[model samples]
Target: MKRFPAAAALLAAVLLLAGCSASGSSNDAGSSVSNPGTGAVTGDGTTKDSGVVGAPQAGDAAGSVTSGSAAGSTSEVATGQRDVIMTGSMSITAKDPIKATQDAVTITEQAGGRIDSRTENPATENQQASATLTLRIPSGALDRTVTDLKKLGTVNFVSLNASDITQQTQDLDARITALKTSVDRLLTLMQQATTTTDLIAIEGTLSQRQADLESLQSQRNFLSDQVDFSTITLSLYSTGTVAPGAPGDFWTAIGAGWAALVGALGAALVGIGYALPWIALVGVLALIVILIVRMSRRKGKAA
Candidate 1:
């Protein structure tokens, strides 16, 4: 009976040990699954836990960060860019220079622009004048302004020009954006700066960035103003009166002859009038001499 009991206890102990071993094996597998650093799950039910920081969060969704940043940079560049140069010219014949200039000024104002300068002078005719005006017409209204200028008088000449500055404008805009980004980074560094030298250096960089930003802003503003307006040069010409002698070849010759004859007769009359005083003096002297000669001869004969 004692032997039987001892054998039964031994068998139970073996089974318990086996159960504990199996439980321990299951626990170890679960621990390995929980700690991905120690294990991995492959695509085919195989788990592999890499210790390389989860592939760095997939590097910003496979270029999402870079693409977004590039898109933002492009948008800023577009807004900060420069504009193209536009120019136009017009010439017309006007009867009155002042009125033409006045009309040009009105047109420029209506077109959202201004007159830069103006000049006027008398033409070949007695009352005719010519005028020239330099005006800045809004880019959108340049064509309309030119058309209005033409309507002021008889059209003589017209021209227009457009110049592209896409490359230069894009380059400037990129530089400005890059500088702004650098300034932002520098500011962040300044916030974390502990040493005095580092702080001072960051301050200097910030100041430089501010100045550069202001300069870029000024340049952009000027460029915008220029691009938004088109320059137009308005010139007025006058038609002179017809010269009398230039017309009617045969009649002109006849009239010229008549004028010459009249001129000769007037000259002869002026000459006779000028000699009258001298002629009178000569006659009085001759009469006195004759009387003296006759009296002297009679005295001599009586003697």
Candidate 2:
């Protein structure tokens, strides 16, 4: 009877010990999972979880970090508000380039636009007067502005380029919104950060999210500016001045060939003019040498 009782007590102790060991292991696993800063966000804006971290814990407010510029692909812009950027270039020959440039500036300013840059070269002895003006005209008034500019001079060449960026705009807006949400969540977690390690981890993530948000905001602003303001590059020159890159016809080809022939003749004349002095000097030197040799031979024959 004594041996039976002792054996029962020993078996009960062993069972309790096993249960305690199991419980300790479970607690250890839970604590390890609760720790942060295992896998951080990579440079390309992807999240990598390190160790066995799962979703937001019981008291934690942050759920998961979202990537920058990778959110919301299905978003759409409003109808009729599609973002389109317009850029155009034109070449014109006018009676006067300076006056045309001034008129162009006035037209752009009147249409609620401005000049981005202007370059003017007064007619020199060797070159005709020319002006180049880069104007930013409001998108709504671009067509009218172009028409008005055409009146300033005779249009030689004109071209317009348009790019539709509505999808890109919507995508950027969505990314900004997502980044904002992520930052807000991180902020909340930062406030609740209980350990130094957790605080550091949250701070790093918050910084990254904030940086991404700012960058996206800047991009959105630039894109909006491009959509609102259409760019036009106007080139003006004197009426008699040849427009650069105007297509050539048969007559033009003949004129170019004639000019090339004239230029070659002129170059040959200049080269001959340079060589004439050297040729005279060599002829004079040869004549003196021949006279001295003849005189020496006569003296030898007489002796």
Candidate 3:
């Protein structure tokens, strides 16, 4: 009886072990079939996963980090540093337009600025002399330069305007980065290409991307310049002043009047010269009529 019980217990234990092994094998097969080629199958019939496939690899991870940092830096550049285009206009009555313009040029140069355009009108007897100057001033010193300019003459008008291009600049930066990436990818593809046809195609795409990158770079440079420099359009008018003369005022006026009289006489002579030809023609025609009338009268008397 004892031997029978012991044999039964042994058979029961072997069957239990076989059942556990079969269950484990089935679970492993199920895992292999469920998550094929993904990861190692664990004893629990689950995948021992690492990183996900098609995700950013180590090399690409660095680039992603750099891109994120660049994006953050761009955001800061857009928000913290303002891209503002400033323009100003001022009208002043100066005692001398020429001197005022010269002084304005000097001031602008001293302020790390340049004169973009300048126009001067000469003084006339009926009109005051004037000058219009377009100056580009450094934004940092614009206020001080404006104050210095105001001291040159009586200010008639003053205006200032500011335009913000922060969003525009950010958008351009993002576009430039994308274009640069595309250009790099195209260059890589070109290097890898073996056939001439493939090379030509990749080169075309690369050229286009490089062109777009350069264009965006140019726009960024222009925007940066505009933000750095402020425009000032200054209009200066001369205050017409006649100086008091100690010696030559009377003689100068008398000489001027004499010149005017001579000019009038010369004009009258020119008019008479032009009319003389017509007058001569009329006199000749009248003389011819008189002769013809006298001849007709003599003929009638004879008849």
Candidate 4:
């Protein structure tokens, strides 16, 4: 009975040991499968953590950068200003064109403007005087100046035009900035170059960029000036009676008489020229008829 009990106890201990060994083997196989060739378990854990934490962080950084750039562009577009050029033409009838022209010049000067050009024709015996003026006025005071000028004479014609150059100006500004940056970079490169070939190449590029920048700047300045000042083409003509005793009245009268005489003589000559062909045809027919009648009489006498 004692041996039997001892054997049974040994059998139980063996079974328990076998079960523990199987469990350990299964765990080892699973660990090998999870981490294939890597030896460090800690490293695997660290890699897992970093992937979980770093992926969202990188995505967020990229998204933030993109959104910031978008916001900056939106703000720039929202704040972009427009450049406008204004021009006008006006025709006025006045009693005296010279006086009206002077008044227009004075008004332009008073409005912080200037006359770009002016022409006046004095009154003659038969024709009224006229004047044409090109004026530059402040854009802000264009309406007021035009109104004041209208008071000088009757408004025969008027035209106003406006052009928006915002896009053009913005494009020029961007080009200028880019060209300047290119020039600066080229200059820096030229300074750092050790070889003559490199220096010459960089210098050539730099000079081209600088010239482009200057041209863009000039265009921008011209656009800015057009925006600042408005142009006005004003024409004035006499509406009242012509003065008979003007300085050139005698010469004008003589010219008029000579023109009328020449016109009459030309008309008479044209009439004569048109009739000559018809007159020649009639004379030839008459001569033929006379010859035919004489030939008939001679034939009758011979018979």
Residues 1-303 of candidate 3 have per-residue lDDT tens digits of: 755554443333333323433453344323322122121111111110011223234345334324543455466775677678999899999998889999999999999999999999877665678899999999999999999999999999899999988767655654455445445544544554545555565565456556656876998899988889999999998774753331247888888789889999999999999999999999999999999999999999999
Q: State the C-alpha lDDT per candidate.
A: 0.60, 0.66, 0.66, 0.65
Instruction: Count steric clashes of candidate 1.
Output: 9
Q: Total backbone clashes of model 4?
A: 0
Displacement of residue 225 (Cα, Å) in model 4 is 1.0
User: Where in model 3 is the C-alpha error above 4 Å?
Assistant: 1-70, 77-79, 240-303
lDDT of 4 by residue, 1-303 (tens): 755554443333333323433343244323321122121221212221222213224334333323443333345567864578999899999988899999999999999998889998998766789999999999989999999999998999899999987656655554444345435534544454555554554455456556656876998899988898899999998887746764457887798779889999999999999999999999999999999999999999999
Candidate 2 per-residue C-alpha lDDT over 8-123 given as tens digits, one digit per residue, 9 for 90 to 100: 43333333323433343233223211221121211111121111124244222222322222222322232365789999999999898998999999999999999999999988
Cα error, candidate 3, residue 66 (Å): 10
**TM-scores of the candidates in the order shown:** 0.52, 0.57, 0.61, 0.57
Q: Give the worst 10-residue stretch by lDDT in candidate 4.
A: 33-42
lDDT of 2 at 252: 78
Return the TM-score for candidate 4, rounded to 2 decimals.
0.57
